[model samples]
Target: MKKQLATALAALVMAPAMSATSVDLGYKAYTSDTKSDNGGAYDQPFVKLTHFNKADWGTLLAYVKLENPGEVKDAQHGKDGKLTVKSLLIVDKQIGDTSYNFWGQNFLVSNRTVMEDNLYLGVTTNRKYGALFINAGVGLNYSAAHFDPTGASFDGISGYAAVINARYPFSAMGLKHSLSVNYEGQIDRDEDHMSTLGYDSYGHQIITTLKTSMTESFYTKLHMTHFDSWGAAPNDGIEYGVAVGFTF
Candidate 1:
């Protein structure tokens, strides 16, 4: 599955007029309060790949979190992390100051993990005001669960959510920078499971990101995310990560 996804993304990026296509590869480290049984923390490293405007189609993005290559396993399904793939399509329709977007994303957690797969379909619109850009959208989400070998099995669940985002551009430390905030709320159902399977009761999430342009084709970002939920596994913790990317 991972190979297939990589191949498809490469094909799209290498299509005609490929020089116009841009790709960024970055490294990210995430720290969370969640811990494993052996008192080891759930901090992990990830490799992120992003492709923009391939064949005038859309942007393709993917990331994979990895466990230490030679780390010892504490359980059958060790603390291996997650993989996520996102495809964003621009509608190319500009009404006054707003532009439209349609997007889809797939989330795949480690094998035997609680959250098996999450699929999303959404439409969004954005507008700019001075140095600020705002976005709003609605989306449908479907989440599947992993079967616990020694616990109760779970089935797939589906729901819908609303999203809003705000971004401000500024200059700091003699570098071009931007600050963005995003919020997603589950209005139709309070148990959408956008983040996790067993943690399905999460109704909302908030994310804040600070990014700086290091060069014409390079940049860096620092981000923090929080999940709100009241489920069996309450994922009400904060996750933070730092990343650096370069475009070609």
Candidate 2:
């Protein structure tokens, strides 16, 4: 999965280089404390890549997160070097303040083959009110998940998904800050609800992120997310993380 994601990111980076729009790369450290050992006090180091186009199409983002990088020696699997990779691609057609888009996202976790992927058709609109700038979007999505952690093949579990995202930004003291919220709900196919052990295979998640700019190209952010499950989705807990980012 990591190799595949790296290839995809390379393609995205090269596709628009002739135009040479804009690119940013940054490193972040994330930590969380939760009741579950899976989500407990763990440190994650991640690298992020983002590309923006001068043309009409939107942005492409790719990132990889490694849990407990280089700390515990000789250990393996979930405790030592768990890997997570994510990628997103957005293509948009804009008409004034509104933009219609088709987007796709892929997520994978290592030491296992649990993967989630989704595609969405959405519209986004931006507006300004007083000193605040607001951006919002909604999408209809189709999602699929595979949970063969041991490499055994299984039937793909499919679902219908809905997504919403909103952001509000304002400036103060010559610095910019923004609050962003995102929500996703996936409802599994009725037949697949009980496919993953005895648990329902669908999930709903909400995340809020607050970012404050330190400089024109550097920022600090805090993210909080809550996962709700109808039956027994994997991400059924709360997580909080802080990150620092830079753009050039």
Q: Using lDDT as the measure, which candidate wins?
A: 1
Residue pairs whose backbone atoms clash in candidate 2? none
- The residue-by-residue lDDT of candidate 1 on 1-248, one tens digit each, is 99999998887557734433344333333333433221222444444544434244433444444343223234224644333333332222223443666756565554433435556678777678998988787778665555455444444546676678899999988999989998876544324233334344436768899989899878888887765652111445565677777766
Candidate 2 overall lDDT versus native = 0.54
Question: How many pairs of residues collide in model 2?
Answer: 0
What is residue 136's positional error in candidate 2, in angstroms? Answer: 5.8
TM-scores for candidates 1 onward, in order: 0.63, 0.64
Tell how far residue 159 is off in model 1, in angstroms. 2.0
| TM-score of model number 2 | 0.64
Task: Please give the range of 10 consecutive residues that has the lowest summed lDDT in model 2.
Answer: 20-29
RMSD of 2: 7.9
The total of clashing pairs for model 1 equals: 0
